[model samples]
Target chain A: MTMAQMDRLLFGDNQFFGINHMSEEKARAQAMRFQKTDAIMEVLDVAYAEGIRTFMCTTHDRITEVADRVRADPVRYADFRFYPCMPYAHKYANAVTDHGMVGALRHFMPSDGVLSTALTGGRALATKEVDGIAKVLIDMEMKMFHGLQTPVIFVQNVFTDLLLGMGFTRALRIFHDHVVTKYGVEPAFITMNMPMLLEALEKEGIERPIICANINKIGFRMSGGFDAYLDALRSGRVRAVAMSVYASGAIPPDEAIHWISELPGVESIVFGASSAGNIRGTKALVDKYMGAPA
Target chain B: MDHKVRIGVVGLGKMGLSHFAMVNAHPQVETIACDGAGFMVDVLGRNLENTIYRDYDTMLDAERLDAVVIATPSRLHAPMTTAALERGLHVFCEKPFCLDWADSERLATLAADKARVAQVGYHYRYVGAFREMKRILDTGALGRITHVLAEAYGPVVLRPKRSTWRSQKSEGGGCLYDYAAHPVNLLNWFFGTPAQASGSVLTPIFSDGIDDQVTATLGWDEGPTAQLSVNWSDESHRKMTTRITMIGTNGRIFADRQECQVYLRAPDPALPGFEAGWTVKYTTELTEDPWFYLRGEEYSAQLADFSGAVAEGQGKAVENDFASAAQTDRTMAMMIENAETGQPVGAPPVTARPTPARKRGWFAWKA
Candidate 1:
């Protein structure tokens, strides 16, 4: 299998979207401050300068603008990478943005009457059709990341768990296959329930997939409970990418990074920092805990 | 109560399946599902361990359910909820409780009369930022909120091609019921039922008969008034973006899903956690993670609250009861009735005034 080197520390885009789990005031301030694309790029450039290449981002509209700039200045961002998380709605479901059940259907429907088609046959999407639908949406979402080294791509937690719940793990298999075959990179899944997702993915014969979830000392948002996560990490069931490591700012950076660094199988830690100092500080912490990224 | 709470989820659509998963995983709950669609029933039946039913009536007849979660379209909500409630089963119906105001009011009364745990899925109420906002507002921190703006925007209808149940006015009631009700319900939650609604407008950006953009004003004679703006055709937003901005005598408050932004003249001890200048509260601190989280903390929290309410009996008050949803339904009905966009008051009969001859005009100018 061909996969890019997973960094000890990766940059994320939650700060750009004004998502703060810990401090709403700080999140609002960052959101207002990063209203302009240049502001986001400035912070991203800081991470890039500090040797943080991978940017884990959702496919929000503003990020498309950011992608345009990144695409234009190739030489400047030669080693720049994107670890895109998609369906934009997945990250924002906490808000009343889901537009209801039919609204979600519209997001992935290839043509109209997905309902009609589903009614006609119990096997709504055959292998080819599933491939077609999955590939079309994936390609469309991946358009902004074109020519950039998107070494890793993620299926957002909402879609991941939805598919998992409906016993449609096949869709995830399809997502994994498409992202791997077409993109030539790792296809990852982000979910709240780590153990359940691991079991579901393994059931689909997707062995040791790259899974990202909330991994903090407090077990904040770790759905299967923190002990289950520790066991999964201990067993090396999957290649873990630690996110929300600070539990949305609840955990101190030192304590947060220390816990993740001591975990057995966390391949990467994706974090968002506003300042050069913050980025460098996190990088230094990662270096201190896990040693510098080779 | 010792025995597991038996729940049957009706309508095997996106939300239905999500609710099933969340409820199915609950340690104290046993979830079954029913759908009219053969494909969905078959797909789920073959995959999941729980029983799947093809017909709603058949499922109700066959299974001994303690409650039913109705996630059907807007029109079906009334009938499905009525059926479930008639069975003396607690009902958790999805939003836009009933498209018909009278029906919604009737159902609310019936649910109360029956003393059943009747709830509506206005999940935003479970969001921590909004919950914290409510806490602060109740404390009179943003004293005497004068005007408020409630907005919900999304990229649902960029360039409409085929019509789904969502695009049909009779079915989903377009953006008003499918999208706008969420923020409108929040408005009702923050302030009581509006005294009046007016100047409502529904613009069909792409769809023919249904609204793609909805705008209106809701006024409370005794309290703050709110301006509602909702559009599903906006591509700028990846998904729906609902925000509430309140301006008051003391300070101002603005919040969405992520964070609550507040500005106060001075720190009020009632909301003593913050200082004077400006304070923001994020959902992370505001929200407590539920036992099982599927989509969002709010989704899981909403379901958790429902099951908890069901388990606790009628003594436990439901935060989002049928009566609150009835108020939202009434507000929605008022907006629909007030929406007089069909007759755009065209500039009253442009009559051409007689013009004087060029020579006479020139002579008059010279004089």
Candidate 2:
């Protein structure tokens, strides 16, 4: 997909692509292949010309330059704001130490480690460690987001599999045991995978809350594919789907549009791009599937 | 068919199961025998039934395999691999090849003498993206590199019972032995050898007297410095993401293992950055395929590569050759010695501690 097309689609959907730093070689390769940075800015400009809005990067060292570049050129990329991923500890410290509030920040530290090792070998850290990490992370958030030096810090929970695998059995149980029981910080919203997550939250006594269904689950576990995702959203298994449309790389415009057509009850999908190609493709996909925000 | 090779697996622990799975599913490989602790073999019975042996010697004697993949505990890798090489079986063994540098070097000499296929399971070397980074560094994109900051933070693999072999210092159950190999190997890979290596490690959480966390610095021969922070008592389960920032004369590059992105910013007047100009120009999601993300493919690929190398009749050279693992083992030995002796490992003892740094603002919060 052209970077412009990808940005357009993501802009239409209110999303930002956050790229992680692994190593120098892989980073260099991604930069060359994805046509990121200056090349991607040209795409974003074109996307803006084509009427796309709200471009954002995941506030990271690998993409901070572009996020800063866009933010500086307010006339052309005024709406571009970098959205840093959260659990707060993982991304915020790095952002504060490195980026210094180029854009917004979001935290999503799964109580369990990423990738679900608790399932493989019932070997998760104790509840105290979880609380400690979360508190340190939350303090970081309060310093950055609550102080209003930056924009809002959205705490996201993309997948609850790790928590469930760690034996919470539900998201609400995690909330109660982690949030309510300990920190007493009632969640403003909760995002999760399916009804199982929601039911778990309900069982834990979480009241009617804003729910974000992860449509991106289809991309990773696409065996049952997109229809299954839509079915879950429509069937009340998922209250409101927060669709993450990009993985591996941004989907081409055609595939993205086809993907949107086959779904139902998608409240919003967070689309991110690495290049103008992804932006333009995403815009076309959104225009085709989500239509103009009337 | 890509010249399938027959293989036998030793030590069917987690790593063993992973290797067996890799060999069985790999397009050009066959795992002949899977041997391990009695309970592990019994549980994995029949599924791994082509050939399974309880005794190590019997398995080595009976299995006329092209190669052997050893995933036994750290203590077993050396002896097991040495025996396999002696028997003319190619070997692909797990890291730290041996606890002692002397033993590892001995194995290296044996490997050279045997002249067979041997390869260490430094599986990180086979990571597609990491390989790409090695290529870029080889091309000198970052210029004359000076300093590198690396971290390997995670939870203690040895559990509360403290009965496992991993919890004993005598058996290589320390943070440096278990976790430091990654950065140490990378350092060796990147900047030849260090002129001097010093480390300070602690075992705050575990009662096993093995270090749970370590901070080590290596001064390279080429005037470059590398710092490593490792912990076995991490707050989370495990995260092996290594963050490498190369300080070069012309420009600087920072890479994060989790995001799989590289940020490069050269000296530019237009850009508002310090003398060490920092900006992230490139970003991308690493392939999160379950097979790849779980490191299943890389493990499989290592087997295939090792088996192929063995099939080429270079068994002794293809697996656990020990030369590479020895550098890390030596560095780790230094770390352990320093942690215990209150002096740099392998260095003359000093009565006084070095000048301590001023307590920083973060100290209070951490406290």
As a whole number from 0 to 100, the lDDT of residue B348 in candidate 2 is 34
lDDT of prediction 1: 0.81
Give candidate 1's error at residue B356 in angstroms. 60
Task: List the candidate 1 regions with Cα displacement exceeding 4 Å.
Answer: A2-5, A13-49, A53-153, A170-187, A202-209, A273-277, A292-294, B38-45, B266-269, B274-277, B315-317, B340-367
Individual DockQ of the candidates?
0.28, 0.05
Candidate 2 C-alpha lDDT tens digits along A46-119? 76675655442233343446556655666765554333333423444334323222111212334355422322
lDDT of 2 by residue, B49-81 (tens): 346777778876776666777888888888888
Q: Every prediction's TM-score for the first chain?
A: 0.87, 0.51
Q: Distance (Å) between predicted and true CA of A152, model 1? A: 5.2
By summed lDDT, the worst window of 10 consecutive residues in model 1 chain B runs over: B343-352
In model 2, the runs with Cα more than 4 Å from the true position are A1-245, A252-294, B1-3, B46-49, B157-161, B236-238, B259-297, B312-321, B342-367
lDDT by residue for model 1 (B1-367), tens: 7889999998877578788888887878988888887444655565567888878899999999999999887789999899998999999998878888899889888888888888999999998889988888999977678889999998777775465577688886688998999999999999878877776898898888999999987777557768999999886664567889999878999888888989998888898877777887777777777777886799888888889988878523368999999989888877887786443221222223334556667667787
B366, model 2: CA deviation in Å?
Answer: 36
